[model samples]
Target: MSRSVSSHTSPVVRVDDLRVVFPTMDGDVHAVNGLSFEVPAGGALGIVGESGSGKSVTSLALMGLHRGSRARISGAIEVAGQNV
Candidate 1:
């Protein structure tokens, strides 16, 4: 299946300096650090990396799945001009 999108449009999602850290018994696990990117209104982004590269962590952060007390997330995430 295929879909069409407008040519002139702003970014639908924007993430800047995103950092997600989890405190473990050993130490703090830096899942994602200083990650930044933007997805245009009709643009697509693919994140590929080796195991334990924080791909799932980044996705969780974007979806606000991490608990505030369990993980430390510092950065800016904007979707549709609204900060989330």
Candidate 2:
């Protein structure tokens, strides 16, 4: 099931059309694809998924943990009105 938060409140964090891909020897590993979300300033968000479902990769991407050479990330991530 998928649920989305209402855009009534100002968001502290916003992500749009996020995609993270890693090129490997055999093929590309798609960690995240077309993911988008928003977290209000005082609101909390939780992410749940099975193993290897790209949860960690999403977090890493949000925290800017992934090296540019190791992963290809294309999307918009905004925090406090600043694009990250």
Candidate 3:
């Protein structure tokens, strides 16, 4: 969505400063950092990345599937003005 879009018709999906980290005994693996984007109602959003590039991790975060995982996720994900 464009930045000029007014607040009255806000985005249907929003992600801000999304970061996913896995703390292994070896070290911390940063999957994503400072990712932000928005998709307006009826709009489409695409995510593309190479293998092991955090695409699946990001999706897992969006779907609330990492609740019990050892990974640490920080940031905001909103759908229809509500946090996910």
Highest lDDT against the true fold, candidate: 1
Per-residue lDDT tens digits for candidate 2, residues 1-84, read: 856766676799999999999999999999999999989866799999999999999999898889756899999999898998
The sequence of per-residue lDDT tens digits that candidate 3 reaches over residues 8-82 is 688999999999999999999999888999998767888998999889999899999999999999999998899
Q: How does each model score on TM-score? A: 0.86, 0.86, 0.88
Candidate 1, 38: how far from true, in Å?
A: 0.5
In angstroms, the error of model 1 at 69 is: 5.2
Q: In order, what lDDT does every prediction score?
A: 0.91, 0.90, 0.91
- List, residue by residue over 1-84, the lDDT tens digit for candidate 1: 877777577689999999999999999999999999989876799999999999999998888889656999999999999998
CA deviation > 4 Å runs, candidate 1 = 1-8
How are the candidates ranked when ordered by TM-score, highest leading?
A: 3, 2, 1
* Greater-TM-score candidate between 2 and 3: 3
The residue pairs that clash in candidate 1, if any, are none
What C-alpha RMSD separates each model from the true structure? Answer: 2.6, 5.1, 3.7
**In model 3, how many backbone clashes occur?**
0
Clashing pairs in 2: none
Question: What is the lDDT, from 0 to 100, of the residue 74 in candidate 2?
Answer: 96
TM-score of candidate 1 on Cα atoms, chains taken together = 0.86
Candidate 3, residue 40: how far the Cα is off, in Å? 0.5
Worst 10 residues of 1 by lDDT: 2-11
- What pairs collide in candidate 3? none
